[model samples]
Target chain A: MSDVTAGALESYLTGRLAADVSVSDLHEHVEGWSRDTVSFTARWNEEGEQRERRLVVRAESDAQIEGDSAAEGNDVETEFRTMAAAEDTSVPVPETYWYEGDRSVLGGRFFVVGHLPGDAPVVWDREQRQDLYRAWDEREANEGDGKADGRAKGGSENDGGSLPSQFVDAAAGIHTLDAEDVSALADCPPDAVVERELDRWVGRYRASTVRPEPAVEECIRWFRSNPPEIPETTLVHGDFRIGNILVNEGELTGVLDWELARIGDPLYDLGYASTYYFAGKLIEPIERPELACSLLDREWFYDEYERRSGRVVDRERVRYWRAFSAFVMMTIGLAGVHRFRTGETDDVRAAWFQYIVPGLIEDMLAIVREDRL
Target chain B: MPYLEPAAVLRRFSRFALEEIRPAIDGEERFVRGQVGSMASTLRFLAGELDASERAVTTQENALHEALDGVEHTLDDHDAAATAVREALADARDTLDGTDDEAGSRIRGTRERETTLLEACDDVLARVEANLDDETARAVRRPLYDFLDARLDAQLRTLGRRNESGDGSP
Candidate 1:
């Protein structure tokens, strides 16, 4: 809730588009707690040519940037730069249009990106998945590339089938990005990213309340005791999942939400995606067969990634990341917990997360126990 | 002393918030209606647990003692091993629950300890449970399960998919 009005947004876009920018439509999406997404359509003229463009402006809200007190460098500028760096890569990122680096203009800095066309529906919907699988199956039989164009009537297929393989391939694509490509990426302390995130979350959660969670404390102790081997460092999409990426014409169109994108161990993304998948299964009680789950299990996922990337996968490292994913999710809950407890945000999602911190710790411990035993 | 219990009044308001007043609320906060519904359920749970949590903690403590006692019978006849386990549990629990001024303190200072009193107790209990045999472990964990199971259920109700009602059938 900055006092930056719709007129300010129009002025900014008008300068960027270099035309008479009149915002035809403008509305902020209420879902994202981290970044407020304002979707708008601008009608502008450039050199006697009139062009209407649909775009999205992502503005940072108050959340600890891995424990940053104020949203300083972790604003829309960072995402704008990251997207610009990732443009030439195989990764399907949105085209970054303009970044308002100075916060004074918009009251808080914001970035605009051209909205890519893709139907990014619920990823875990069995009916949607079944359709995607059937489309791929059809594509394999008829098309030369054997890649589905994301068009098929869902619900007939028994499993996700080849869709899982494609998803893995797309994930590995991010991992395969050369460090030289993302040259502007900051250098992290060697093998300290996990510990950094752990401390960051701990700081946030501790700040939230006088009450403490023993499970998380124990998990942190365990994490400190048994540090995993650092696999090759690459551009890790801090949040990677079916929901984060757009699926269009039966292929991954674009990866969305660059807010959490960073350069780190590729396994970070794998762990995050896997934990998210595991959490969904726990909550939704989807009736996918046990064998189907096994097919898309962590090991299978690693193997698929290894085969695609031509890099040898470490069993221990993958296991650690899988559990670490849960730990990260648990830590992330602390931010929401802090917001809820402080009554700064009236988000029920925040309140719900505050209530579920214990359960999150429980889930993390369960994953760690499974990994260990 | 009153016509209706305080919790009953809370439950009435909570139910009203979920079923009646929530549908009328719209926009961003409208999405939080389901969570508000969850909060209502949690309030009811807290009210129910208020009188019983002390007993639950005592039962868990006794369960831990019983688990150690079982280990002695399973291994040795002497009370040395059983006494040691009992002392260990007490030491962990006291360190967790007691302050610097209190007796048998395991903590250096009050603020030095990272986890809360209950968290410390849970850590000790978890460690104790992890060491025991299957039967002893189940015996030790049953009380904790009994205690937190209801709480977990209440919290879990909040985690359900928003905008979804009834059976999520295909």
Candidate 2:
């Protein structure tokens, strides 16, 4: 919003859409913490008729959480290519129209994509949405009470209910995308995937360290000593979580936030998906439990993943990567704290980063101990 | 000099002579050595204090659990007390928004104190789980330990931020 005027965005859209396209009602979505996300309605004169369209603009911000620079440079371009490649494939990504990596376009890189029809329930704010529990219960009942194959029939459960099945199905679709078809990222060698990713992140960590942590040093040593053996190479939706995915009426309409997409071990996605409980939520079907359940319950999603991908997932390897994912998340949280403390960034989200890092560390330690012992 | 205790006089003389007198007369190498020695000693003192406090807390927590073992139904009460303490800590944390420098410092102190308390709770719970024959005692301890573990984690995150801030430095 700093220098990204509506006129610039409209012009950019005009170039992508029809010549008579006119954009109206540009507003920001405040719920998203990652990108400078803005949802706007576009009205255009097309074929002797006025057509209305909804579009979302995802632009990079000066202030960002850690591990986002991976999305910078040609990374966004790679994402665009990946999305385009997955168009005919099973993955349900939004159809990207225009992407501008140049800084001059809107003071930072951004992409415009087709706005899919869906509504993401206010999952973050659990209080107002007491109806979610009822919705979840109804879906479970319908699935059990001779309704249909709820998993196959995507998003038919109406009444604006919870979309847990949609979420799982969309994830399975992504996991099953033909790895051989993604030729654009063929240069990414499978063997060096771990090393490349670790080096890139470690370099970022080193640069961002205002004060060194002995624990980080120890963690690095441990990571190097006990690198998990890669079983299979697949495209990792680097930030595969409930928040990044969008669902409508019990069906996944679009898989958003491909900024963190990369070619790596598929378990990274599985581990990340399972760790959503740490963000404070119950398992998929049971939207509201009387008490919090173990994140391990979400392993059914992994079983579903294995079923779809036809790969026997090594549970021990998945456990190892889960700990690694937690460590990566902790590093990002630490980076946010570093930036905020150094006055490099002035954002309130930075403070929450401090609140979450320690919990992540403890969780990571717990995972490590559980795996080893 | 007359008013000063012997220990205070020796400490004052050592600090003054090492920091001021030795630096004035000695070359850069000697000054560097003196500064390094001072820092090392300061670190050693802090490390010693932390170690002693940790040991004392562990001992007291162990004794408390040992005493509670004989008392029937006391473990449940103790477990509930620990939960209440954690809830109080959480409430305190929720209110802290780092409004001012003093508030921020207080929040940090509270976080560290809560960490210590939660760790103690975890140690006690772990011991109870090991010693108690009753399944209820073990069941009650599980949630308490889990909550305390999560709480300790949250506090450690806050501590990580504080450490990154270089708060006490001039």
Candidate 3:
């Protein structure tokens, strides 16, 4: 879509890969919301023998939440650096092969990584989700398992099932990383991580809002007035949830979309994934407790995080971050509405995000005030 | 001449999505069809609530005005920037509040829409909170914040507490 063609990719890779590398089997991905994803086969001659490399290239695109540059969506560099850091860690990440920020390389900046074979299921796709959940149900029925962050890598083709414990384990895996060890992750000044994060989304909000949002403004003031006590900074996967996770044959695969991953309160990610969603899902359960339970209930998710990460989670800290997460999400909606009204994209879903801003405000108030409106 | 009722059209389209569109598509397209179905239902729901919605808005706005002027919750100072915005909104609101006979047709019809005042209020409050000191900001902004939150709560109430299946994708 961005003048990215097979021939152009081949030309770029031919020089980058080897003397005579041929790019073929190229197809532009149709599923992602943010990045223009391209998956192709690159063949190269090494020692007079032909070798094929399966690669997925993440093309640099404008931020999905244009208002929030700090948002975890649509940035390629964050994903590349984060993946590089997680290369040898307990966190399962796709091997990043080569990254280039120079736009001149492929008409825009893009990064190539070894393609991990697994499907990162879209949550909106109810049919596929039902199938996956059914698989989870069968597994849970037989195994009697709901252990948090189950590390067991096992699944079958039909079931396309995975353990909820495994997903939590993956989150725990990222939380377990020593922030200092990952050279790619920058260190926040001691105890200023959350404030720095607040500045990030707040700046992004001010940059892209189409209209003034008093609810968000109030939430911002509240966060500033009531800073959560941060004991430590760990790798925060800004959007750590089932949607960004890849699953294959019930095995926990690599985490995708590291654009929002940052160094901050690790609990922020936990509250973010659960509070931003699950509140409604928990209400309906939609007849998929098997899948929902695997991911978890509210209390279960909190307990699991503490149990697996071996980190004490202060409820107030979570409450504060939950409010911030809601603010970040609301601003993203504002940006989306701006883009749509300005005709940046035609998706009505952008407007859909704005509609939920009211409910999310209620959610934030519930967390921050502990007094429901 | 006869025209199809809007609700009927939505239901017709909803049926088409179920019988023709959803079955005919696959991949993201099929999932989107389901979303279309969800949206169709919500729109139908909204259409049903439209009469009640207008009343709900009036009720909420009246409460907000009462709250804005309530003695117990009053701001210590107008805090200039916030005052400008609130004064402007008050003007807009007064224009809309006038009886049709009491004001010229042009003023009654087109001086400023009611939602415009509401948006201006939000804009003013947004600016006020960002710039003022935390103590002064909290005091100046609380009534407006409470009003907006209550307005949202009332708005949701009109919609009948239906938990919308929001953007299914992250």
Best candidate according to DockQ: 1
TM-score of chain A of 1: 0.80
| Candidate 3, chain A: TM-score against the reference | 0.83
Find the candidate with the highest TM-score and give its number. Answer: 3
- Deviating ranges (above 4 Å) for candidate 2: A63-74, A121-124, A128-143, A146-162, A178-180, A183-187, A210-219, A276-296, A371-373, B1-170
The residue pairs in collision within model 2 are A155-A250, A155-A251, A358-B157, A359-B153
Each model's DockQ?
Answer: 0.20, 0.05, 0.18
lDDT winner: 3
TM-score of 3: 0.74
lDDT of 1 by residue, A1-373 (tens): 5434668877887777667788857766654557767777888787888888888888766443223533212446767777787776656788888887666666666788888777664535567656644543454554355433233337322123354555676687777765566665665553876666556555655665546544555566567657776746777777777667677766567887766766677777776775534324434434332212222445666776787677777766655666666666655666666666776667656655554454455456655554233
Off by over 4 Å in 1: A3-5, A62-73, A119-163, A202-205, A248-251, A276-299, A370-373, B1-3, B6-15, B25-88, B92-119, B122-170
List the candidates' TM-scores in order: 0.73, 0.62, 0.74
CA lDDT, every model vs. true structure: 0.57, 0.53, 0.62
Q: What is the lDDT of residue B48 in candidate 2?
A: 35
